[model samples]
Target: MDALLSLSNDLAAAVERVRGAVVAVNARPRLPSTGVHWRPGIIVTADHTVRSDEDITIIAPDGRTVAASLVARDPGTDLAVLRVHDTDLPLADLGDPGSLKVGHIVLAVGHGPRVSWGVVSALGGRWRTWRGGEIDQLMRLDLTLYPGFSGGPLVDVKGRVVGINTSGLSRQLELAIPVSTVTRVADELIDKGHVSRGFLGVGLQPARLPEAFRRRLTGASEIGLLVVNVQPDGPAAKAGVLLGDVLVALDGAPVGATEDVQAVVGARRAGSTVTATILRAGAPAEVSMTVGERPSRRR
Candidate 1:
């Protein structure tokens, strides 16, 4: 009983520390949501929770309501950055999400300063969404994210923000976009009003290489991305890439998953050429293609 009581006090204190930087975002005609005061005059929330750029109100920690303007938004990561007139807003101490490990205790604080505690259930490496958004890291928690909790902060016991929690992107799991990803995306959104990504115009799925082929490429991965479709006149098609070809590597880096391809393509500028190593008919071949800017609609 003593141990349980001590744990409760620790959690309560952590929540109280984080509550100083938490804000309730009331985008009219939409449900009230939560946001983190990431910096002076800047609030970060879930992009899905923010319906529009106009007529938004921010309920500060002290319960003083003030108007806020939408600075920028990225639907791919489900993050939005809003600007308020108040520079005195308390800022959250951002933690390194990369340091988070499975079983670590985390707290999600939402509107009304509601707190939910849980453990980090899983952590995934870099991956791309079906929409082609490049995520630096994937973190999921075993916590119940209630309504209006979409844009809240997921913090550690030290009261440092681990990430932004959102339920809009995943149906079966509670996902927190890591602080590293959020910082990168938020910076780009603030500077450019949009995020740019590279494209190859090819649909790919995971495929396994035959035993003999895997042995031939001793240092290479056993799995690769199988091209299922190629857009006509697109970069891949223009470079003679075809359907059914298995992409094994990009510019010397192993291409084992869709995320690997995305990471390579996203790192390159449009109009730049990249060497694609593929297995066509059980034989390895190399093809060079110019990277293209990913269409905004696709993003």
Candidate 2:
């Protein structure tokens, strides 16, 4: 039918529109992935794809192979940035992924002619990645991400980029890092060598509150975090936090579990101050703690 023909034509046109920015990233052994020329001289790809930092190469759309240097990488978000010079790869034409709805037609475009088409299968609220990265929004696709497609672009019918496709973020399903999240992470990596996650050096376990206290703390969690260990000379200890204290809330938000605490702190930068409400010896008290930067990796 005419409708079918028009739709097919549009899809081909879409691929033609955005293929220039797509490049093959050879940072790993054997299995190469895709990358997008996100900004001038800046390439973005799945962090997991870049296994070797020293000898990374980028195969451009024009069949030009260029050397790339690792700018910074955040395994938490499965995103990495690489810098390339002496190339004029076009920047991706980005679109707002927030406008995507379930069942919308989409395309996954990789380097050269590699691509797959599917629909937006589902959408969810903010979620935390397996790597403990906080995603601004959850986007699931019903498309196939062929090998070497991990860092490619997911585009709309008109070829505007919606997100960066990646399988490293999730094991069982195909997902894309939304444009909003991609830009934010890329900006941070460009400004700073690493992504800063807020930290309060203390170990904690979840504990239920007494019924009386629970009723008093209405609109908050019935369970609170029991401080088990406070690192000496660390943020919590510096703020006079003791091991026996029960952390009931942070910045007026009740924390019921470790994840609740992580959700609050992960959004903040280092040097930010937060008010932690704690129960000391069965008496409620509050302390101001200055947030610290979590070490990117454990020693």
Candidate 3:
């Protein structure tokens, strides 16, 4: 009975410690404001949490509420950072997401007053958002997350944040982007004011070149992405990339699949030029294209 009491006390203390750093951010869209302690008086949340509004507040540890502003946001990863004018607020310690492994025990903290238990289900899980047509690597957890849980913290046993709870696929499957990915993109957003990524204005399809075409094309592959249509006056069109051209490589890396091209361009900075090798008219040729801004629809 004494040991049970002691363990209960320890658990209570741990919850208190996390709650101290956890804050209820009164953001638009009503997502659960799990808290973040990145810097003095600074907190991080999901980009979608505060993207559509201006007035925001952070519910502090001592039951104090303060106004805050959206510091930065990266739409690609759906992460955002917030800053409070006051400097005395407690900050949460960020854990290295690389340390997270599948089957590791995790605690999902949200605005409600308790930490929920779950286990990491998958790593490097890729999926596309309903709004943004891009692939984001996600960490799946075995928790039945709620709507307000978006942007909350996924902590380890020690109460260190390993990832930010982003979205859910089912009642039992929760998803999050690793904190390391958020940190990387957040750093860029802090410095550049936006997530810069390369874009090629062309819709592609997988195809096999005819035997005669393959014979003349040195780099043509029967199992690579082929350009079905190029957007008029867009990056690929401006670079003289024509329809039916087979994309062989980008920046010296082979692109065998449609996702490969998307991944390469999606990771590149906008306005930067990249070399693309293409099989055009049964001949291998190189083209230079300035990565353009992707349209909001991603079409």
Candidate 4:
């Protein structure tokens, strides 16, 4: 009984410690999500929750409503940054998400200072989100993300934010974007006003190579991506990649699927270059292709 009481008190104290950094984000029409004061005057929220690019506002912890401007948004990672002025809300005390172990006690600190306790259910290495964002790490939690909690902070026992809670990333599982990823994305968004991803303009489909060709390309996979369409003047076309070329590998990594292509391109910046190994008419060749920025589209 004594242990239970102590634990309860500690959780409540944690909520109190993090309350000031949590704010109510009103960017969507109906449902308002939460936001955290990640840095001074910088609020981070879930990108999906920010339905409007203009006329956005946030309700601070003290019930003071303030106007916020949409700074930049990265839908691939489901994170958005908003800028506020003339507010003195406390910034989040962040902890290392890498230190989290399975079954470690965690808290979701949301707007209105709502709290839900849970454990770190699982951890995974580098992964790409369905929307093509490269996440540094995967942090899953066994907690209920209450309404308006999508952009809240996932706090540790010491009241330090370890991640940002979001329901927008997955349909079946609750996920928290780890602190390292959040900081990296947030910094990029703040600096460039948009996250940049390397792109190669080409339509490709998986094609199984002939046994003889597979043997020739010793380091590549049996299946390679066959170039069906090459955008005119695009990265691939500019690099002298012709149609009917089967891409065997990118930078020595065998790419059997589109995800594999993304894994390589996304890791590199727009101005960087990648080594593309291809089989042109059953003959292996390599092309040095400079990566291009993926053209931004209106959401």
Candidate 5:
């Protein structure tokens, strides 16, 4: 019974420590969400939460509402950084998500001083979105993310922020953008007002190689990305990459899916040469292509 009381008290105190760093974000025409005071005059939140150019209101812990300006936003990672003037909000102590393990206790804190307790359900390594955006880490939580919690912080037992909660990317699972990813994106947004990535103009899908071909490769990967389409006059076509070629590796690293290709290609800059290994007509071939800059989209 005493142990149960101690646990309750610890959780309560943890929530209090995180509460001061959270603020309610209200972007007109959308439901209210949460934001974290990352530093003096700087706030971070999910990009999808702020869709319009209209003004944004931030409700502080003491119920003081103030205006905040949208500094920069990156839809690829679903992260945004905002700036508020004349404010000295408490900043959250960021923690490393790479050290998080399954079953570690955590708290999801949002506006209304709302708090929910849960454990880490799963941890995933680096991956890329279909749009070719790279995610540093993927985290799944056993807790339910209620309304107004989309851009809130997920805190560890010591009240350090582990990640930013968002359900925009995943449909059935509660996901958090890890602190490492958030900090990197936030820094780029602050410095350059945008993030840049390399692009390879090709549509691809995962394909399994025949057993005989796999044996010929002899320990090389059995799965690869099959090129379905190549953009006209784009990097792939310019480099002689053809339809029906199965991409097996980039820069000597094996690629089993589109995400792997994205991770490799995105890491390079425009005009940089990268070697691509592909299976063409039952034999492996290497093609070198210059990476291209990803064109800005109409958002």
Candidate 6:
């Protein structure tokens, strides 16, 4: 009985370490407390958790409840920000989600029926929401969660938060959008009230050059981005980037994948002009285009 008691005490201590960082978000009609908290001062949570409600009330571990306001959120990434009264609070240590690997021992911290424990079951699983939007860089966990745990923390054994408990996939598959993504966008949301992303207005797909085409061309692999569609009045259209065009490079750098183009374009600001090199038919060419701002998701 003493040995079992010791083990229980040790597990309780681990939960207590991260409990201060876990908060309950009570937005009246939404739910009594939809587990949310300030990472010191920066409030983070799942987008869908607070989308339907207003006037959020944040409850601390010691039973202190304070009013919090929604700052900004992106449904695409399942991330949101909240601002509460200025107070010194304990913050969780943020980790690099890009560094997480499968089979790593991770903890899911939430206000479950009671608190619970779990591990990362998988990684790099892609998911789409009800709105037909795709979520990137999702970490899967083997934990059970509900409305109260939507915005809780997923900490490492060291108690450092590695991801935000965003959503659950199945009975055994839980998902957390990386904490890095939330932190990055949170800065933009707080300072600018919105995330300013550049848009190219072109749908691209990965295509590998056929061996025959690769042999005729002196380039590696023949892999390139095939323009599937160009928005009617978008930056790509205004710049004369048409359908069937093969994107090869951006700003003099080789574009090896669709993500490369997304990175280059997503990094630019609206009204910023960039040079895109394309392989048209059998000829190499470039087009100068000005990027445009993506539409704000806030109503």
Candidate 1 displacement at residue 53 in angstroms: 2.9
Write down the TM-score of every candidate.
0.78, 0.94, 0.77, 0.96, 0.82, 0.70
Per-residue lDDT of 1-299 in model 3, one digit per residue for the tens?
Answer: 99889755655555666666677778875554655766676677777667455788877767778888876776656777787886575567678877888998777887655567778988875555543334446688887566567777887767787777866332355777776676776676667666666689999988766787656645545665689999999999999998888887787776778877877787667788889988777677889999997654321
The order by descending lDDT is 4, 2, 1, 5, 3, 6
| C-alpha RMSD of each candidate structure in angstroms | 4.3, 1.8, 4.1, 1.4, 3.4, 5.0
Q: What's the true lDDT of residue 245 in model 6?
A: 87
Candidate 3 residues lying further than 4 Å off, grouped into runs, are 1-13, 29-32, 125-137, 168-172, 201-208, 215-240, 251-258, 270-274, 288-299
Best by the lDDT measure = 4
lDDT of 6 at 210: 58
Q: What is the lDDT of candidate 2?
A: 0.91
Best by TM-score: 4
Local accuracy of candidate 4 as per-residue lDDT tens digits, 39-101: 999999999999999999999999989999999999999999999998899889999887899
lDDT of 5 by residue, 183-236 (tens): 888998898787778888999988998888777664557788899999988899
- Lowest-lDDT window of 10 residues in candidate 2? 211-220
Give the runs in model 2 whose Cα sits over 4 Å from its true position.
210-216, 219-222
Which ten contiguous residues of candidate 6 have the minimum total lDDT? Answer: 126-135
Clashing pairs in 3: 32-148, 37-92
Clash counts for the predictions, in order: 0, 0, 2, 0, 0, 3
Which clashing pairs does model 4 show? none
Across 49-70, the per-residue lDDT of candidate 1 in tens digits comes to: 9886788999988899989999
Alpha-carbon error at 64 in model 2, in Å? 2.0
lDDT of each: 0.87, 0.91, 0.72, 0.92, 0.86, 0.71
